[model samples]
Structure formats: C-alpha cells, structure tokens
Target: MTKHERGALSANAPKSGEADLETRLSRLRAALDGRAPRLDAPFPAVTLIFSVSDGAARAVTAQGSGATVDAAWEVAVTDLHRKMGRRKLRGRFLRLDWVEKAETWTWALLRKRLREVKRNYSRRGIALEKGFTHLFLEQELNGNAMLYGGNQISHCVVNEKNFLIYAQQKYGSGITVDFADDREVHVFDTAGLFCGEDGVLHELYGAGRNAGRRKIDPLDVDTLRGIIGDASDFLAHQVGADGRFIYGYHPCFDRQIPAYNALRHASTTYSMLEAWELTREPGLLAAIERALEYLCRQFIRTAGDDMAFVVDTGDEIKLGANATAILAMSKYASLMGTDRYAGIMENLACGILHMQAEDGSFTHVLTWPDLAVKERFRIVYYEGEAAFALMRLYSLSKDERWIAAVEKAFGHFIEKDYWKHHDHWLSYCTNELTLYRPEMRYFRFGIRNFEGFLDFVLQRITTFPTLLELMMAGRKMLDRLKAMPEGAELLAGVDEAKFEQALHFRASYLLNGHFWPEYAMFCRNPDRILGSFFIRHHAFRVRIDDVEHYLSGLVAYADYIEAVAGSSDGAVRA
Candidate 1:
C-alpha cells in the first residue's frame, strides 16, 4: 500500500474477526520460529502484547488455517511501523481490540523510542525532543510540563528527533545527547540556568536574556519598600529628558505603541509620590517632579472662558484627566508642605466641577480648545473620582465650596449605587469620605461594596481559567485587603480573623506565581520596561494605566500593612 493509504489505516485497530485466539497464536509462533517471512518494516519495530485481565500464561500449540485473518493483523502492524517512520504522531497514542467474544488481548507499546529524550552531561541536565533542547523545565499550576529552549518552548508534549535538531541548531556543537526516553522528564540546564539570590529561577527575556525576576517578600516592609523603590526607578527610566513618559508597549513584538493618556500620567505621578513618601528615594522624587512638570506643560489646556483643564495632547479633554491631575497635584502640595501647585490644582478642580451636571454626574469628555462636550454620556468612574478630588481639595484648602460639592456629588453617587460596578475608586472615595464625615450609612456602603468585590475575587480565584484572570484577581484581593480594615467591624457575616488569613493566603499565591511564571510575561525592553497587558483575551497592548493601577494598588496595600504592624495596640484603626 501507498504511504498515505498506510498512514490512514494506522489509526484502525485489528478487528475481532481478523485473528482468533488459536489463529493469532499460530501466526505468532510461525513469526517467532522464522516460518513466516520477516516483514520489510519501514522503521525499527518494538511491539508489546498483554492481556487486560489477569490470566495464566500458556504456550500456544494449536495450528490454525485462517490465512486471511492472520495476514490482516500483520498488515496492521506493518502499517503502524510505516506511520511511526514518517513521524505522524505528535502526542501520546493508545489502541484496544477484542479478539474473541469472551476474551480480549491488550497491547501497550511505545512506537517512537525517542519521543522525549532525557540525558545527563557532566552533572548538567538536558531534555531533547523534536529538534528543541530544553534548558529549563517547569510544571504549570495545572500539572502540565513546560520545556523552555533558548528560542522557544513547548507545553505538555515533546517530540524527539525534531527537538534534538532544533537544539543543536540553536546551541551549536556543544549540544550532546547521550540517551533517549519514552517518558517525559524534567531536565535542568546547569550551564544556562539562572537562580536568584533567593534560590528561585530567574526569568529571562530578549537577546541579552536579562534576568527579569525581582525578588521581594510581599509581607516584609523592607521588601515592599525595595519594590516601590525599584518600580520608581523603572518609571524614572521611562521618562524622557523632554518629560514625556513612555506610554504604550507591546511585549510580544518588543516594540512601543505610540499613544499617550493624561489621566494615566497623573495617576502614575501620584503612585511615584507614594513611593517617594515610603522610601524618600531621591531618584523617585526627581522622576515625580519631571512627570508633574510634563502634566503641567503638555496636558493642561484653557478654554475660551479661561477655564483650564488637563487634556491629552491638545484637544481631547477627559473629566478623569482633570480629576486625576487635581488629586496628584494636591498630594504633591501636601507632601511638600508648600502650595507650589495649589493654583493649578484649583483650576483643574474647577474644570471638573464645571463638567458636573446638576444631578452630580460629570460629562465624561470634551473637545479642548473650544470646550465643547465630546461625550455627554455618564461612565461609572469619573463622577466618584471627581468627588474624591473635591474632597481632597477641601481637606487641603478647607474650601467650603469643595466640601459642599462633594456632599452633593457623593449623595448622588450612593443614590445611584455606582459602586455596584467594578469601580475601586468609588470604594476608595467612599472609604475616605466615611473617615472624614463618619456617617454610618457611608461606612456601611463602603463595607457592602468591598464585600461585593471580595465575592467577585473569590469567584475569579475558584474559576481562574486564564493567566490574566489570575493576575487581576490577585490584584483585586490586595485591594480588598487594603480597604477591609477600614470597615472590618462593619462587615456582616465575616470573621475578621479568617478574612485576614484568607487575604494573606491569596497574597502568597499571587506573589509566588508572579515571582516565577508571570514575571516572564512583562516586557523587559527599556522602552516597554515593566509594562503588562490588559487581559490575556485582549490585544497584547500595554497601556500606562495598567502599570499605574498595579503600582498604586500594591504600594497602598503595603503601606497599610506596615502601618498596621507599627500600631501599639496591634489593632486596625478605623
């Protein structure tokens, strides 16, 4: 038969009528005794036949006359050999057949001897399969084996000769394989492998294969301080001498996507300020100043009426941009103990307030130079953000107008149940407002919102089907931990101690995963350094807001935990 025809028949098992017990025994005896012709096999043949049932082994002495049935079994075996010779099978294979009515024989075999090769060279480990030499072996959380080669990696299954050839081509003549195996094995590459000072494998990326893993104990204050410091340094590097921070990055392509957002720039600056407050790092302070300058110089635009708002580039004005700028500048002013940017903050605040409707919902966007409304539609976040900014302004300046605006806007927010959506900023604003005003209803609302958030997190953790969901869920859990203490006593149906323990466990799981597998997903290029994509389901584009949210959430939680540790009573203060 032709190769194609033989390949198709390889999937078919021997039929029951093809060989009975006596006929199969006679053919096997003839083949073993050299009474049958040795088949012209296309590849090396190794066959193992056994019974599924526990039975006594008996010698076959009966001779049969079913030549047609015996010939069919021979053809089936030869066809399988041909398919193996052509490397048709890519994964594990198995087959079963019933030879008679009451009895059946089982066959267990490895058709390809070198499907996955495991070898040791001078105490170093190497896994060679299908032209790829895997230097690193990792088992995923779901129990799948991953083999990492220099240029590529394979998941779950490995192919034999192809891996070896690929490894030799990539690693050169030094690549040596001493043995091959049918079973998968974990092999370590002593030469190319990297381990951190913590003794964890260091993730590498790009042509330099620079180690990307940042070892930090999430629970340790000093470790959190160091992470914040390092992140601040990365942000510092992203800032151009012209004061523009690199905004968008694509990791898989190792390229920058030229886009910018004023809102993200403001929030990122706010995070840097928080980092600086924690560590007093001179570099972080400098970067924060540069970013603040960028927002003032390029982002702020004035309308025809001299009402100033922060805009992305020149004409696109978003309420979120103005609110974020007001928030960041106000924090910087408070941190510096000077009113250096107080006027700018007031102007941004006024711009946001102008956009608010009588009902307290802010218009989402506007066209700049002319100040024409671009989008009158209400979104879930900007109103809460504006209210929070107003509250912060009031706290800083003791402005009654700002406080009155917040009171009205926040009442509208609660009446509308805006916190029902995935708006952490809403929770943040309500949490802050509760502390300032001490309204039982506001506090209760904050608790209920966090409870809902926790439920969402629990659901995501239990049903984490994608890496993005896992990462995002971990981040949301941290947010909950940071916010929970404020309303711990108010949380209904939850034991505070158990809730804290669950948060700690969730944090540990996230940190462990991030330090190992997830770190590799971040782009390491200087332009796209430390940027993460949105969800795994979306296009692989990294936005500044993604980085901003991650940093702010982590820094806020770390600070909260550290503060709780330092308290004399060891109790979380309301």
Candidate 2:
C-alpha cells in the first residue's frame, strides 16, 4: 500500500491544520505515554503553547525545565496560565515540545554545526552578521515535529538558534548567572508532540499549512496543480523590473544569494514556459517573456563563427547555457506558435554543434567572442542538455542534422554507459529522441537510466527534484514500450508494478520540499519564500533553479495524472 493509503498522512505525516484534534492529540499522547525523566535526573524542558481561536488570548507559550517531569510540566503550565490570564480556554491549536535527549556539547558536534551554519548563514551580509546568539544550543526534531507555528518548530532536519537567545533578549547582552563556572553546559536534542486542532492545556501542532510537520495528501492532478501553482506564483513574484529574477534567497536570514548564473536564467525561463504551457495562468506568460528577454538581450553573444553562445557574466560561455537558451525559446516557439526566435535558436544549436568533437563529445566550456575552449568537461548535464536542445529543434524545424547529432551523442553515451550517472536531462532527451525514432536502443538507454534506481528514490530523504523528472520521462517511454510486442520482451526483467508504485510515491515525496506556509513563515521573508521549493538539508535554501526543476517535474506529473487519473478543473483548492 502507498504511504497515504496506509494512514500515514493522518497520524504519521504532518499537514497543518488538516487532521482532527483527536488525531493530533493522540500522536502527542502516544509519545508522552510512558517516557519520563529518571528520578532526581535532569528532566526534559517542557513547553506548551495555547493558540486561542476565540477570547482575548490569541496564543500563549511557556517553557520550563526542572528535575522531574511533573515539576517541569507544572512550571510550564504555570507560565502558560500566567500568559493566558484565565483558567478556561477554547478553540485553539496546541503544541508541546521538549528535549527528548540532551548530550554535553562536544568539539566535534560543535564543529559540524559550525560547518553547517557557515555553509548557509555565512554567506549573509548584515542579516546574520551581528547576532551574538551563537555558541549555544539549537532544537532539531527527529522528523517528528508537525505544526511549525504556535511558537513551535520541529523538522525532520534541524532548526537552530532556539537556544541562541535562550537566556537573553538581545545581542551583546550577558546573563549574570549566580552559579559556579565549572559546571557542565549541555546542548539539547529536542522533540515535538504537536496537538491537532484540539482543546485547552493539550499540546498541539499549529494550524500552519506546510508547517514542516503536517502530512501531505496523496497527489491527484489537483494537488499537483496546487503546488505547481504555488511554485509558479513564487517564480512570478521573483522577477525584478530589470527582467531578471533576483537570483534566489537563502531565506533563513532573508539573504539574496547575490551570485547569478545565466544558464540557470534560461533554464528557469524554460521551466516557467513548461508551467505556462500546462497552466496558462494569466500572469505567468508575462513573467516568462520578461525572463526570456533578459536572457536574450543581456546574455546571448554571437561568436566570430556566427555561432551563438550564452556568455556567462565573466565573458565566458557554457554549453549548458546555450542549450537551455534554445530550450527556453524553442519551448516558447512551440507553445506560442511563433518563430520570432527561430534564427536565434538555430544559431544556438549551431554553437552546440560547434562545440561537438568527432567522437560526439562536446567541450563543456569556452571563452566568449574568442570561443576558446576554457574547460573540456564540467558536468554530464551539459551533454544531455545539448542533445535535448537538438531534439527540440528537430521537432520544430524537422532538420535531419539535429537528429544525426543526437544520434552521435547517444552513440558516445552508450559507449561510455552514461546512464550510470542517473542524470535526469539524459532521460528527458532520451524520451524526446525515442518519439521520433522509436529505436529500441534509445528505449533501452532510458531504462538503464532508472534501472535499479527506484529503491534509492524511495529510501532517500532529500527531495532531489530531478528524480521525478527522470522517472516521469522514463515512464512515458516505458508505457510506449509496454504497448510494443518487441518492447514487451524487454519487460521480463523489470518490475512494472514497482515502477508504478515508485513513480506515485516519489511524486508525493517531493512535496516535502515545497514551501508550505507553515514552514515558510519561519523564514525572514515568508511572503517571498512561500510557494517555492527548498532543499531542507541545504539550510532551507530557495533557489530559482531548484524551483525550476521542481516546477517542471510537478508540471509533468500533473500532466500524467490528467492522462491516467482524470482531471480536476480548478485553480488551487483550499
């Protein structure tokens, strides 16, 4: 059974404000049933928050640490009562969080955390620069925390800085403790038992949607469209007046990434086009065109050989940039039925062809204008993107050279067994290739790309957006193969049902990375961050390319759902 099919979404998964109060409280009660601190031992800190749906008190939170569970519970309740200023409470969300484990801070652990914090927070300018809330503890739930609000936070990943200002209200402020200096200072490992929309005094998960702890419903087409709409809206909002996306934001500190990539610009535009084709949302087309115009007007440069390369900001050119440039415009032409960019797309294709060598390998990087090979190779994505760009051109212009170029690249790919990388672009191009020449070789290559890979896709935690893109493209090819008598022979070794299961599960799993309001609200700029996709492990970064891959993948999955599972004709449902 699917995770959702087996009641995972109700109690086991986190979805903000959706589950019944009884169900949410049951999860909390189940956790607090037997576990308690040892007698005379340092008890876990108990925190209770009451969010009033009515009455004067909107929400109240109180945290207490003591030598016993009851003591800690009483201290917390006392503080909560003081804040509520009344005994009777009604119509509120509840959340309870406590330290599930506490360990003395070690040098190794501190170093690891410092590295993580530096990786994400170090890039900021004035945002995190002046906070003295360091050299302290943070709270990270073991994937069990649900509602992120009601003055609570729990993530399958980790949330830091809870203890940064634990004892102080401001930076540079010192806490004059009346204790011995030789005492052991311990860091905590915390857990959250968030209540559902239940009643008073019970811990609860807040009513925050996508609050990092809520369960995600199994995706039908409508669900996919909702997330896709959210993400696309985020992209639309990200565009600046200069026709460029403001790159992306780290969001943790509301820091703009500062660095920009032309390649990602074109690729992001391509993703917006994918959404435009699928959604045709009113404001989306303008955003897509403005982004495209930025790419063409600012980045594209024609070489002395009459080939066009998307020059990187530093007077350098990358093969991937040119490919995605073609992809963006080619997709635009295909969707809008316009050839305004045909000449430009042709030159871009020629530039990719120019970079190709006799063995079908392309130089991945070069200096613009001079067209000098700067680097022979960078990433396999470049090769796959090149091939895909060619196929896109072939579909539009019916040029045989584009076909032959992809064929040659495929020859090189097969010779080297490129499928081992499990790159999504390769799968995408391979799917596009087989459409024209239903060659078994291309079909086999697509299979090999995902062969023995679903287990990884299922078990992995990080929401690698490309996996669904790979699977969706490959599944279409697989479906085509299933229809062919000769193709049916190839299926003997594959588990069709397992493949189907993985596709459904992976599509659902990626939702965890989406910027639901519950989780997004914790960031500095919730409005901007909301409706985007994030890599939780990467300090909850919201990058344009990340959103692009996510948006493109969801758009594809939504399309597939419409084909097989029927359709839901609506915008985003509540």
Candidate 3:
C-alpha cells in the first residue's frame, strides 16, 4: 500500500521540485570531492538511516553534522558506509536536522538547549505518555519539530511549553515515533529526505509534503466519508464481547491508558451511532448495541426514584456523565425506531433536572444512591453538556418542561455571558433549541460563541476535534440566519468569509493527527490502533474521548456537506 501523507509548511520550507533536490545534492557531492563549486549559501546536511535485523535485531540510524558540506558529509557518509559492513541498508534516507553557519546563538545557550533536549527524552511523555502539558515530548515524524544543537531552530515547532531557550524552550522529543518498525525516525529539522530507488534517488519527504505521500483532503465528501467509515470501524473494533472499549493507548510504547471515564464511554457510543447514520455497517451496529448495553448495565443507577443518574465507578454522579448517557440512549431510540431506553432516558433526564437550580446552573457533581450534592462545579463543560442533553431528550419526548428548563438555564447563560467559553455542547444546544424557538436572542447568543473563536481554532496545532464540532454547529446557526428575512441586517458584523475559511481549515487540520495506516503501522499493534485520532502534542495519546469528538465532528461535517453540497435528501439521520 502507498503511504498517505499531509502537506505542511515550515520556516524556510524546502523547495518543491525533484530537479532542485538533485542540484542541491550534486553541489554537496562536488563540495565533498574537493571540486568545491561556488557555494553562495549554507549547504544542507545529508543523513542516512538504516534498519538492523541482525542477531540482537535492532534499528540503527546514523546522524551527523559539521561546519561545512564536506565536513558534515564525511561524518554522515562515513558512518553510513561503516554501518553497511554487516547490516543491510533498510532504506537510504536523508533528513539532515543541523545546517552549518545557521546559528547566531551563544555556545553556552546551545549547550544548555541540547542538554535539556536529552533531559526531555527520558521524561514522562515517552515513559508515561503524559506530563501535565508542560514537559511532554510529542513524538512526530516532522524534522523541524526539535531543538537539537540549536541549529535551524524555529520556535513555533517547539513541543509543550517547557523549552527554556525562548522564555521556555518548549520543543519536545525530536524522535519520530511513527517510522516503520523496520525504518528509523527523521526529526528535529524542517525538511530534506530522498530515498534511493532503482539506482535513482527519489524524494521521500520534502517541506511541501510529509514522508513520501500527498495530502488527504478532509473537505471532499468522498474522502470525508471514507475517513468516517474507517474511524467507525476503528471504534467498533475497540468494543469487546463484554462491550467495554479498549480505552486508549500511549502509542510510544503501545501501552493502554490506565483509567476509564463513564461519560466518555457514553459519548463514544453516541458518536458511533452518529456515524452509523451515514455508514450503516452491520458490524458497526452490533458494536454500537454492545456498547449501549454496556453503558446501561455498567453505568446507569437504577435505584433512584423515577430519576436515575449515571453513577461512575467511584459512586459519583456528574452532570456531564448523565447528560452523555441520555444522549446515547436518545440516539439509540431514534436510530432503531424503538423506545427501548425511553423509561431509562426519562429517569436520566429527570436526574439531570434535579441537579439544576432555580437560577439555572447545574450542581456539577452529586453523591450517588442518596443523590446528595457533592460540589457546585467541577468543570465548565458540564454546563453545556447538561443543556444539550435536555434539548436532545426534548426532541424525543417533546416535553415542555425540558425546553422550559433549558430556557431557564439559558437565562443564566445569557445573563452571565456563558457563550464566551465557546463550548461545543452549547453550540449544539443552541442549534437544537432554535429549531423550536428560533428567537433572535438565542441566535445572537449562539453566533457570539464563534465570533472571535474562529481565529483561535484556525491557529491551534493540536487536532482538537471539538473545535470543528463547534464550528459545524455554528455553521448551521449561520445557515439558519441567512435563510431568515432579517439575517442580512445581522450579517454585517459577522465576517462570514473568515468564519468559512476557519471552518474549512480546522476540518482539514484535524486530519494531521489521525492514525492513518501509513503512520499507525509503526505502532506495536497496527490493527488495534489504526484510524483513531491522536493529540500529537501529547505524545499521540489515543483515548475514547479523542475518537468520540473526532467521529462526532466528522460525521456532522459530512452531513453538512450532504445538505448544502447538493443532496436531494438533506435530513441527517438519527
């Protein structure tokens, strides 16, 4: 199978032509031969990577750098030739991180950065896959994503904000963790990779594209559907005969994440159904039912008097947990055309309503069984999640109390300006609510959530799937307003152009962190980990929630494409 890659631009990105690469290589070859042609620029270094399948059976990659082309060439080529004695070359690869005369920093600072780089490699993201967002080393295949020896360094490519060089040299581990099990990683600089094939050196990686592949456009309907199907398959595969998901993985060493979240389990099941609307795979359906059965049996509290709440493992009820449980049940009811979980949903919804106050904000957590208040707040996300869940229940039951409670809660949201958080669930609720109410106040509130938020989403490097979900919900709101006669007057303040661009960019940007087969094959269990979404900055952490948001967003975006991009049937399935 051909490798799939994404196009990314970096500082001083390498040129975009094979002929140009050959000329650059020729210049280096001549400089090494003492032919020393007119060198008007700092020549790029060449690196050779090889795979070791000998007795002890390991991978060996030799990297080198020096003051000039000849000097660096001698170090890299000499090492490459030396290693070729007994071990065969896996693939002759080149991606030189350090460039000569490409520095202006003091020697003291350079030594410090390299020392820190060594210090970072042995830290938690590699060892434990988490470091509280400060010192995590994001293992990726990009060359310019490191701070080694302080040559050709770019601040934007730094890892978690722990790098001390620029206020905090935030660059993480430079190791490319996704190279083939048989191939070695090429990281810590922007670009340059050519593989020897059929007696001719061919470009395997360049600044314009990632390792030997082209970009996968997430906006295209066909590509989006294919990705959605793959993601659905991945999620389905995670479900076991007992109905529990595989949870997640660290991926650096392929260790499973140690904990589980009931809320995430419910949300994941909900998203699988959402994708099922488009891809009605029987195996996927079976997995969804198993997961739903797991949710009801493992998480739902049956003892609450006509008001059941989802109790997590610790015997605690979270506003978000019950909300997602309600969502999953509600989706299941609508999908199979049965009311199997209607009573359970009503109980869960009532349980959620009990957690709300007269002034409209949820008590974030409560003790299970007795249903006593544990805390007033745990996280801001629970608020939107609570509102969205009520709206979902209202769709199935048409309960006036549900909408009324939501409106009462929105009073708090509007009064306190809760839209500032730009939560995806709030956007979801606003869209669902306006379908019934369609009031100007709700429309105005919904639009503000995304007003200044698009810029942040567009610029964020992490594959934050919720951001796209927020944008998709906001787009539905925008489309609704445009259809209204009064929308033109309100459109003046909103930059529709910028909003669309950000939405499109974010939808595509998310693909960067996906575990396509090309990269996922490097993991310990390729079949188990393939097609899930990962947070690259977090050492490629793949958990249930990550895939949940990813599947939900992609399914929603694909539905959006179907509706506006010319489908005779514009309705999104249950």
Candidate 4:
C-alpha cells in the first residue's frame, strides 16, 4: 500500500479516550524534558510542536492525531512555522509515531524492502545496483512497506536510470517523489525504516527526523568577513590581465556565459574599488587599475561635439553605463589623488546631463556608433544612477552645475513617485545627496522611502522562503534603519514589535546570505571553480550586478557599523 493510503487509514482509526490522550501527552513531555520514556511502549500517536531557543528545546503545544507523524511534521514545519515570527530562532514540529519494534526488526525489514524495490526497478530495465547506496523505508500496520533509495552524492539516484518512474511503477499509484537532479528526492515511507548504504541509518534517521528542529547559529560577523574576502578574491582572480571580468556564469552547467553588460561592468569595477578601500588588498587594487584601463581604453566614446560618454564595448551607449562610469572614474581619481580621469569624468557627466530632460529624467539609452537616441522611456534604476553620478562629480569638482542638475532631477524623481518602489539605488543616491546638500526635504523623502522599504519588508518577511531574499531585503534597509532617529515615529503605522522583529530577522539573515553564494560555486573544475551570486527565485542565473550589489551592500553596512562604534547613540549619523 502507498504511504498516503496508509496515512489515510491511520487518520480514520479510532482515537483513544481523553485519559489515554493525557497519558500520551505526559509521555511526550517527558521525552522532551530529557527524561527517557518507554521507547518500546505503544502510545497514542501525537504531534508535538517545539520551540527551540538559546540551545533549549521545549514542547510548546501538542495535538492528538492518528495520522502519520511525518505528514504532521511536514505541516507543522511548513504551515505552522509560516504563521510564527520568522525571527523566532527555531520553531519545529515533531511526530512521535506509536510503534513497538523488536531489536533490529525495523532496520532489517527496511533493508529487505529496499532490495525488493531495487530488483523491481532492475526488472524494468533500469539498473539500481550501482547507485543504491541508501534506503528510507516506512511500513503500515497492514505489513505494507514503502521504499526510497539514494546515491553517494546525497542524491536519491538508485542507479544511472529514471528512479522516479521506477518508484511509481513498483510502488503503485499515490507514490509521490519530488526529485531535484538525482541528488535529492522527497519520498514517503512508514515501518519506521530509514537507512543509508554508509551503514549510518540510525544516525541519518536521528538527524533527518529532527531536521526542522535544528538550530541556526546567530549571524557571525567573522564569517561574513570571510565570505566578503572570498568574494573579493573571486572578483580579483576573475579579472583578465586586460581588466575585463568574467561577466556571466551558469553554475548548473559550470560554463561561462559569453556575454557582457557595460553598466554591470562599471558597477562591478566600482565594487572592486570599494573592496580595495576596505581590505587594502594589493591584488584588488591591481585588478581595479586593470579594469580602469579597460574602461577608459575601450568604453569611453566621443559623441557629437566631442561630448564623451562611456558605452559598452560592443553594445549600446546606455545612460546607466555613463552614470556608473562617472562614479567609478571619480572614485578612482580620488583613490589616486590625481585628475587623471577628470576630463573623462566631466565628459561622461556632460553626456548624461545633455541627455537629461529639462524636468530632470535622463534618456535611457543611445545607439553607440551613430549617437542616436535608442531608448527614451524611463527604466527602473537609470535615473537614480544618473543623479548619483552627477552628485559624485559635484563632490569631486565642487561644480554647481552638477548640483543644479541633481536638484532638478530630485524634483522630477519625487513627482514620479520613485519612492514607492523598492529601488535601493534611489535610496542610496538620496542618502548621499542628503549628506552633500542636507536639505530637510531630502531627509524627509529619504526617511519616507525607507519607511516604504520597511513596510515592504514587513509585508514580505513571513512570505520569504529563502534566506537570500531575507538578506537582500535586510541589506537594502540596514543603513537607513541605522541612520533613522532611534524611537522616531517612522513607518508611522508599523508597531515597535514588527520593527524590532525586522531588525532581529535581518541580523539572522546576514550570516545566511553571506554564505549562500558558496552554493553557486561550480564543482566540476576545482581550479576554475568560483562563486557566483545568483537570483534565487529565478533559474539561479548568475549576473555581474548580483555580485556588485551584494558586495556594495556588505561594505556599506560594515562602514556604517564602524562609523557608529564610538558614538554614544551607537546609531549611524545622518
């Protein structure tokens, strides 16, 4: 019988009386309290909800149920946990299946069932002997069993064959298997059999059944520093001698995507510059110099009237590219204490300024060779990027024109409701502008934008399934959250609980997010293996901007923390 069928039967079984239910609850509590219960005793099936905090686990609630414990455990972990504060350290649901087992009976039965399943698959022309390294089995009261097999790489591959179809055909209908490659699969089993070919079935069962109860260590700053260092090294090593970075990587296939984006390239260079500033790493500085050379030699172009702009080597002259180039050049000039890129920066800044409409929004793109306007519609981030670039130029030269353009652009950005979007570039530009200009309106708008961001985070925190999303949202808001006046009536309607929860969860998310890129490393070639920042919700496509934004956020947060260290308020100053 299928596990689901057995589960349905179990759910419909007669429930014990109230007294028996109380007895089972007491036994479950005893187990949680570290007191040994009668493991051989058959007690009423129960679902125990646990909350683990600060290294202690306790049963927060319990419910009587005849359903299979795994089903209840899954529901508790996914459904119930979703309703709880994600800031809660570790919340899990565990099932205590009431069964009496003879010594080694469960393990032996499980192994026998696995072999049977393997033979069945073999008869169907799908070999199962080679990769049948692990087995998970569960049996019902009716003596029927369900089986699953896995391979060495933690994949549920029972051979170099289609295991999903094999399981379904051998186990009959209602046998569901969720497979990701051949390494992972979700299988349903009952006779309480979980074993691996490594002869560590007991260990696997002990760990797997309580997986949801595992505690996640608090975000570690040292670990984050290590990841940042690794990412910096990856960026430095990926830079060609000519200064071009490997622009795109496809992790699944371990291949380099032969593509490039000028805006992304410039932004990545700017991040590398920031890394150099933070780490004073000689290799990073060398890489930055090489990248600067490539940017200046190949990307800078003279439009009509000797108006210079930074364009992609073989692509359109995007406004974003020009804006990012201006920032990168300005930063490089500041680092070297020279006006080496001053003329080029001014030319690029002017090219962008010329594209700006009188109201302040810049045209999106232009054709490279012909210098004809290619796209005029306002894209998501280019306007903010352009404004920030102009502001950076203003900082470098004390040019009133740059400020004048930014003032006009700020007015246009406000009128266009850019604050309503979760665009970090807008917040970043506005924040820097506030530092330079210190206008009350700029501060107010910046706070309002962050309020919107907090609201976005609050609304989505419970819905975030992965640590990457949580970290992205957290990093985007950290600086603003730190800079806002403590106890300020910001995010007007958001209560203090939610605000604190957001902060707490963000701290937890950073550690997880920092280490997440390691998962995207290409494993096929150790020498060529490198980390790539990916979009988790998408098909995990790696992009240069992904790394750029991640590095920028990390560095910015680190700077904020360092600046606030000696302050009495211990908060970032606006």
For every candidate in turn, the CA RMSD to the true structure comes to: 19.8, 8.6, 10.2, 16.0
lDDT of 2: 0.67
**Candidates, ranked, TM-score:** 2, 3, 4, 1
Residue lDDT tens for model 2, 22-105: 564456545564554332234234322222222222123345555556666666556555554554543244555554444454
**Alpha carbon lDDT of residue 251, candidate 3?**
68
Give me the candidate number with maximum TM-score: 2
lDDT of 4 by residue, 29-120 (tens): 33333211222213323232322111122122212222445444455345334433443533222233222221222323334334544221
- Residue 445 in model 4: shift from native, Å? 1.8
TM-score of 4: 0.60
TM-score, prediction 3: 0.72
Candidate 2 Cα misplacement greater than 4 A, ranges: 1-47, 50-167, 170-211, 304-306, 567-574
Best candidate (score: lDDT): 2
- Model 1 residue 29 CA deviation (Å) reads 52
The clash count for each model shown is 10, 14, 10, 5
When summed lDDT is taken over every stretch of 10 residues in candidate 3, the lowest stretch is: 123-132
Give the distance in Å from residue 347's predicted Cα in candidate 2 to where it truly belongs: 0.8
> lDDT tens string, model 1, 1-574?
2111111222232332233333333333333332222222221121111111101111001011123435444544454344434443321111211111111111111212112322100111233332112332221101111122212321112333444554464346678544334343332211111121111222122111111222233245554454455556667677777778898655433567687778888877876786677778887788788889988988897654536888776577888888888888888988999899888887787888788778777788888667789888657677767877887888899888787787778777778876566466765676556556766567556545545455444333221112222223333333454565654455544444544544444433333222122233222232244323232112223455654554565566566566667664322211
Q: For candidate 4, which ten residues in a row score worst on lDDT?
A: 195-204
- Candidate lDDT scores, in order, read 0.48, 0.67, 0.64, 0.51
Better of 1 and 4 by TM-score: 4
